[model samples]
Every structure is written in C-alpha cells, then in structure tokens.
Target: MLIVEDLLLLLLDDETGTPAKAGTLPYALGGAVLVELAMLGRIDVEGAGSVLSGPKVVAVGDGPLPDPLLQEAYDEVTRKPRTVQTLLLAIGGDLWKTVTDRLVERGELRRESKRVLGLFRTTQLPSAGTGHEARLRAAIRGALVDGTEPDTRTAAIIALLSGSGALPELRPQLAWSGEVYRRAKELEKGHWGASAVGTAVARTTAAIAAAGAAASAAVITTVTT
Candidate 1:
C-alpha cells in the first residue's frame, strides 16, 4: 500500500467511515504524498536542514512514477517550487476522493451508497475484511506502545498521525502513555536519517500541525461567536 493509503486507513474510523480528525485529513494526506515522493527520490525540499524559514518543495526526478497519484504529485512539484503549506493544498485539494477510489478498487474498502429521504445520496466506506489495517495497527502499536523503532514507512505514518493530532484517538488500541506520546512527537520532528527526505518530511509535518491548529482555532472562534 502507498504511504497515503496507510495513513488514511489509520485516520479513518472503521465503523463511522470518517476521519478521526477530519479537519487535518486533507493536510495529512498531502503530507503523506510528499513523504512518499521524498522517500522515492522523486522530490526534495530546497533547504536540507533549515526549519525556521519555510521549506519550498522541488521535483528532482524526470522519470514517471509507477502510480498515477505519485506521478500527478511529481508533476505539480515540477510546475514550480512552493512552500510546504501551499503545496499541501495544491496536491491534497481533491486527494481524498482519489485515494478513496484507489482503495475501493484494491478491495481494501467497500463502498455502500444510501439515500436520505430518497433525495440526497451518501456513501460510506467500511472495511472489506482485508485485515491489512489490523496488521498496520499492530505494527504502529508496537512502535508507539512497546517502544519498538519503526522502519521508514512506519515512521512516516506516525509523523502524519502525530501532526494530525489523531494519535490520542487510537486510545484503547494503543494504550496511550507518556512514552508513546514522546515517541510520536520525536518522529513528527522528522529525523528520517536521509538529509533531503528528513527536511521535506519535517517541513511537511510542521505545516500539517500548524494548519491543524489554525483550523481548530477557527472552529472555536465560530462556536464562541
């Protein structure tokens, strides 16, 4: 599964078929694609270690990616270098639908359609009994709860989950603790070992967190007003 797919699975509520933190889903999904492209050597950030100034994302590879989604992201980067925040929206604007369609095609999720008052249509994606998400959760749970160091892909998912502020939602399954929270926070800092990948991932995670915070504040302000 692609990193974005894995991240989406973790964020989505299995029964509700909605994101645990819907406000950050778009940004997190976008960040997932950026992380995947960086890992694949298809993209990089302008600054390798600078976190103070916003990092601008750049496309480095000219070859086509195996997946259409990755190729689309790479092409967007090739158009022009943009700050991590801007690029996230650019890539993630309609990503939820695209990624959901991909998962449905793979049979990892099944789509059910319904009508409200026989006038409006809605769709929900429930698990297809693939058991992939179960294994994924086990691996992540081991990393967060058991202090097991995760591989690069797993680390990326953790970073996205942390940035989205969705880790606490794992709750009983993960048995949230101080150590688990600290481990997740460390990964969110994006020390991914490779210089280019690390910087890009770090910037993307930072952007996601910032965006999520702003969204929360806006919701609060609206409710208060």
Candidate 2:
C-alpha cells in the first residue's frame, strides 16, 4: 500500500471511518506521495533553488509509475518544478476522493451512503475488517510506545503523521503518552532515511501550519462579517 493510504488508515477511525485532522488531510496526503516519489528516485528538490526564489521540487526519470495515483502526481511534477508548498496543494487538492476511491477498490475501506433528512446524502468510509490496518497500528504503536526501531517505511509513516500534527489524534487507540509524543517529535525532526523525504516533510509541516492559519482566518472573517 502507498504511504498515503497507510497514513489515512491510521488517521481514520476503524468503526466510524471518519478521518482525523480533516482540514490538513489533502496536504498530508500530498506530502506522503511526494515523500514516496522521492524515495522512488522519481522526484527531488532542485539544488540551485527555483527561479521563483525557493527550493523547487522536480520530477526525475521519464517513465510513468505503475500506480495511477503516483503517476498522476508524477505527471503534475513533470509539468514544472514548484516549491514543496505549491506541490502539496497542487497534488493534494481534491485528492481526498481519488485516494479514498483507490482504498475502496482495494477493499481496505468500505463506502456507505445514506440520505439525510430525506433530501441530503452523506457518505461514510468504515473499515472493511481487514487485518492490514490492525497490523499497521501495531507496528506504529510498537515504535512510538515501545521504542522499537522502525523500518524505513514505518519511519516515513511516523514522520508524516507527526509533521501533519495528526499523531496526537491517535489518542487512546495508540495509548498516547509522554514517551510516544517525544518519539513522534523526534521522527518529525527527520532522519527518516532520505534527504529529499526529510525536505518534503519539513516543507509540508510549514505548509500545513500556514494552511491551517489561512483557514482559521477565513472562518473568523466569515463569522465576523
């Protein structure tokens, strides 16, 4: 499974299917894909910086990825180099549906829709009872709670969750504690293996913060206006 899918599974409630940290979901998802691409050697940050005056992430290699989602993100990056912040939204905007659709197709999640008030419809993505997510949680819990050394992919997942600020939401499920929080913070500081992946995580962290501030400002404006 893709890192983004794993992150989603971790963030989503098993019984309710509702995702945590909904506002930053797109950026988190997009960041996951970028990190994966960097790990695959399909993308990187331009060493000289962009003409637009910031570090620009560029697509490498000419071939397409086998997975449709990765391919789509790669095609976007191939079009032009952009700052990590730009790519996060460019690649992540509207990705909720696409990524969720892929998970549904994989039978990892089940989608249910119901009419609300007889005229409105609502959708839910409850778990499909697959043991994969259970095992995933176990691994992450072991690393965060038990101080077990995580593999590369597991480390990346922890980094993404930490950077996106969704790790705390794991709550009683992961048995949150000072040790787990500290470990997550350490992962957030990088050392996840790849330099490019670390760069993406750092930039994505800033982007998520900025995006959240912007959203909050908009909400405040709406209410005050």
Candidate 3:
C-alpha cells in the first residue's frame, strides 16, 4: 500500500514553496496523474511511492515502459513542471494573460483544452532554449524543484523569463509589487512611515498604475495598428 503521508512529504519536499506548491493546483494535478498511472499498471503504487519518498532513482532501462507504468511515471515526472506553469499563469502579475496566451501560442498548453486530455495530445513541451516559451518552462520547473512558494517562485520565474526576453518586462515587476502590497499590509500594523514601509506602498502603487497604463496602451495600439 502506498503511504499517502510519506508520498506527500517527499513530493512536498521537492515542491514546497515553489510554483508546484502554490495553492491546491499541484495536488489536484499530481493526483490526477497518479490515478492515470495507477490504472495503467506501470508502477506498483506502494513501490512507486517508496521510490518517490527518497532520492531520485532510475526506473531501469526502457524506451518508455508499459502504458500503465509509463503513464504513472509520466505524470510523476511532469508534476513539478505543470504546477510551476500553472503558478506562473495564476500570478503572472501585469502579464498574466499575455504570458499564458503566448505560452499557448507556443504549444506549451492549449487554452481551450481540458485538463483531462493527455499531455502528448493536448500540449507540446517546447524544446529547451527554443525561445521564451522554453525559458518560461524551465523557470517554472526550476522554481518547483527548488522548493520555493508558488507566488514567490512565480515571481522569480517571471523575472528570469522576462530577462531572457521570453516575457515582457513589466509583468514581473507588477507581480513583485503585488507581493510588496501584501508585505506592506503586515508592516503597516507595526511600522508607520518607516523607509521600507513607505517604499513598499510607493512601489505597489506605481506598479499598479504602470500595469494599467500599459494595458490601456496595448488596447489603443491594437485598435490603431
């Protein structure tokens, strides 16, 4: 029998705080994948859970393995990546829609596709270094494996993607500013008019305004051009 708690701990250790750990998204997604794998029979649930609970282990030689095992392993391998990607979409800050739409355009995901659809059929994982899409994918994956929180991990991933020109620069800034707002609220309870407090509020407001202006400009540009 699979020890649910042990599995959770192992996965959590690998994904905690990173994009994969963000909200309930990872658990929901990973659970679905686990179910598919279990049905396929590629993995013995108990054994698989044991392996995942510790250091990474090669599953022996194979082109893919049996459908059942393959399916289960596939989901397991991709859990962190998917979680990170969703986290990015969820808190993309100013560029939430833009980033996600672009990713869809590049075949990382299909905006109209259902989650139950097979990943191979519904989405094409981009080749590493192919473009901004690849970079974004890498960023999300990195964040998840590093055990960063979803929001914070997403922010860092956005920063990396933006730096690489995969994303527009303004979006990451906005996301970071939103974080500042949350932090500021906490600070306001104790520190009044402190430099950090003042800075946080100012940055948050500026980011919001910039996002709004950018959005408006985009609308105008789209209409005019």
Candidate 4:
C-alpha cells in the first residue's frame, strides 16, 4: 500500500464513512505523494538559509512513476520549478478522486453514493475488512497512547495526522493528548531516515501549512465576495 493510502485509511472515520475534515485533506494527500516520491529517490528538495523559507522541489531520475497520481504530480513538478506550497496547490486538486479510485480498485474501500436532501450526491467509503483498519488503529494507539517506539511510516502517519487540520475531528476517537501532539510535531520536523528524506518531510509539511492558509484565504474571499 502507498503512504497516501495509509493516510487515507487513517483520515477516515470508521463508523461515519466520512473524512475527519474537508479542507486539509487534499493538501495532506499531495504531501503524502511528495514524501513517497522522496522515499523512492524520485524527487529532491532545495532550500535556502532556513528550512521553511523558499524550498523548491524538483523531480529526479526521469522514468515512468508506477502510480498514475504520483506520475501526474511528478510530471507537473518536472515541468517547472515549484515551491512546496505551489506544488501542494497544484498536485492536491484531484488527489481525493485518484486515491479513492485506487482504494476501490484494490478492494480496500467500499464506495457508496447517496443524495443529500435529494439535491446533491455525496460519496462515502466504508472499510471493507477489519484487518486493514485494525492494524492502522493499533499502530496509532501504540504510538500515541502507549508511547511505544514507532517505525518510520508510523511516525510519518502520526505527524501527517497532526498536520492534517483534522485534529478536532480525530481527537475523540484516538483519545487525544497534548503530549502526543507535541511528539508528532517533533517527529514531523525531525529526521525520519536519511538526511534527504527527513528534509523532504519537513518541506512537505511546511507546504501543507501553506496550503491550509491558501484554503482559508479562498474561503474568506468566497464568503465576502
């Protein structure tokens, strides 16, 4: 499974069959793609004096990416010099549909559609089996609640969850703790693996923040316009 897939599974509400939040989901999804590409050595990040100040992401090793969604992201980045924020905005637009299609194809998620008030259609994804989601919950509980040492992927998931802008939506289910949130933030900024890999995560996370800001701005403009 892809890192983004794990992220989707975690972002899902088991009983509700809905995402924890709507706004940050796409950027987080895009961030997951960026991190996965970095993990595969298919992308590189360039930074100036500081980490968050003007980080540019470039694709590495010209080749066809296995996943279509990732390939699309890779293709867009290679076409131009994009900062983490710009790339998040660029790549995140269609991530939900792409990721959900993959999940449906793999039989990991069951998709259902319903009309809301007989006006608009809405989709929901319910878990297909217990094992897939159960393991993810176990990892989260172990890391956040039990204080066990988490593997790199698990650590990244925790960090992504914290950064995902859905904390309030997720807090009750996981028994939220301030200490856990702090640890995840530390890990998000810390090195998860090689120097390059860690830098990639930090840069992507900063981008996620920027994406959130952009979303907020868009909402405000829409409301006041």
lDDT of 1 by residue, 110-192 (tens): 89998989999988887776889888888888778887777777877887788667888852246888988888887777654
What would the TM-scores of all predictions be? 0.83, 0.80, 0.19, 0.80
- lDDT of each structure? 0.74, 0.73, 0.29, 0.69
**Highest-lDDT candidate:** 1
lDDT of 4 by residue, 1-225 (tens): 888888887777765468776666776787777777776778776664233323678788877889887788889889987777667667876788878888888888888888999999988788777488678878878877787777767766666666665654662377777886766666555434442345655555544444444554455467679
Please identify model 3 stretches exceeding 4 Å from their true place: 1-22, 47-225
- Please write out the lDDT profile of model 3 over residues 1-225, one tens digit for every residue: 121111121122121111222232222223322322323332221111121121121222234644342334454443442222222222232232333344445543333323444544342222222344334444443433342333322332232222122222221222334444443333222122332323332232222222322333444467678
Ordered from best to worst TM-score, the candidate numbers read: 1, 2, 4, 3
Q: Candidate 4 at 40: error in angstroms?
A: 0.7
Identify the superior model by lDDT, candidate 1 or candidate 4: 1
> TM-score: which is higher, 1 or 2?
1
Sort order, lDDT high to low:
1, 2, 4, 3
Candidate 4 residue pairs that clash: none
Determine which window of 10 residues in candidate 3 has minimal summed lDDT: 1-10
**Candidate RMSDs in order:** 3.6, 4.5, 20.1, 3.7
